[model samples]
Target: MGVLSAEGVLLRRSATDKDDALVQCAEALVALGAVGDDYLTAMRERESQISTFLGEGVAIPHGTHAALGGIRRAAIAFLQFPEGVDWDGQDVRVCIPIASRTDEHVDILSALATTLSDPAAAAALREAEDVDAVLALMAP
Candidate 1:
């Protein structure tokens, strides 16, 4: 599968808290066969060290260098929490979980950053109704 696919785009999700949201993101990545089960722990550790909240109701959750060995392939899972989740004080509606080896994540991050830099694009992603809409908005 590609970095972002229709299967990776999930809408109308809900999380009770930040950790819950992270867990859901990690689980989605695991389900996609992008990362191993231990990836969840790595994601939590990364979050504890620093906040992933990128503003505009979005958060990017990814594993750390230590978790690189568990990655099966590079992929991204997009989860939209319609009710929103509290991410360190900021309310986040989107949680994008990324799994990559070496420096591959940098390129993925750059592309996503560019897409999210536009207010309209970010808003569209947050409120996207289906996977196709999300794919279009996130298209590089």
Candidate 2:
């Protein structure tokens, strides 16, 4: 429904989609005060269902259950790796965790996925040193 708080942005020096991804996602959600221990556990369990992948060097590992009273306020998680994570046998680096009940979230992710695929956007995201810089490229 709304963009996550600035605190929700997690700038990962290294992106990971395995068990390590959970920690980074949880950190960002916790910083926003949108996630708790219960939500974290649910998210971890949901990962076993299926792997969230976006072709062209991007994958999103998300939790389906939800946080913020099970309403799914936690919309996304950002975990970027300098090297990359092996996803579905493909090497991926940028990770964005997503959970939402609103259409905006889908739109945003679509835009990001498109951007990540674009040569210019991908280059910029790859070079970014911090979340502020990365957000700038995605910002309108």
Candidate 3:
């Protein structure tokens, strides 16, 4: 299996706040066996230092370099919130939680950034209804 699998993609989800979304992201990463339990704190610390909210209703939440030791493997989780979560001041429709070894983190972010830079692609991801549709959109 690759970094992203059908099991990692969740659709039609909702969050009351940004922290709620982040908690779910951490849980998903844990459930996927990608990161240690403490990764949630790292995620929160990352968010505190810098907002993860990318443009076009998408947010990529991940741990900071210090937490890289907690990652068991490279993996990504997709959570869709149709109603949108307020991330600081930005409205986020999708939360993409990433777990990666230290060396692979930049590369994964680069590829995902390339794919999401496209307006249509980002929009498609936010509105994707099925697992296959999301998997296809997120393919690197």
Candidate 4:
């Protein structure tokens, strides 16, 4: 369970809505073998239950409470939609999809919140040209 790297970061993505963004992010996690196919369904279900949009043009999506069993590893998939997407009532420009087998989800969300809350860091992430830039913003 290492920190998310370039493999989990997607930049300049095109997504129409929250569903599209969620699917794209979840697919990235699946490709990384961080979670099973069931994770996608669980993520959608979780979204339907409550919007993960955390304001600040960001959204943190994760599987349902009961879908923890499908998590094989702790990882995050970040999708940066330059065009933005309609996340419930909020406009989300960044999507962070998380998959974890333990309580690490809380810590990750806390860290992400701290980073995203900073105008400079949030802007850096949205305007980053490469994965390295994005990674640096996340951990800086």
Scored by lDDT, model 1 comes in at 0.87
Worst 10 residues of 2 by lDDT: 65-74
Best by lDDT: 3
Best by TM-score: 1
Indicate the worst ten consecutive residues by lDDT in candidate 1: 102-111
Evaluate model 1: give its TM-score: 0.94
Residue 7 of model 3 has an lDDT of: 90
TM-score preference between candidates 3 and 4, better one: 3
Better of 1 and 2 by lDDT: 1
Candidate 3 vs candidate 4: the lDDT winner is 3
How much lDDT does each candidate structure score?
A: 0.87, 0.62, 0.88, 0.83
What stretches of model 3 exceed 4 Å from their correct place? 103-108
Q: Which of 1 and 3 is the better model by TM-score?
A: 1
lDDT of prediction 4: 0.83
Candidate 1 at residue 31, lDDT?
Answer: 89
Q: Give the per-residue lDDT digits (tens) of candidate 3, residues 42-118.
A: 99999999998888898999999999888999888999999999999899999989998755546556666876889
The global Cα lDDT (0 to 1) of model 2 is: 0.62
TM-score of each: 0.94, 0.75, 0.92, 0.91
TM-score of 3: 0.92
lDDT of 2 by residue, 1-140 (tens): 24544455555556445566666666666555555645666667676677666666666655564443553364565666768776668776666665554554676676676777688787776656776776665553
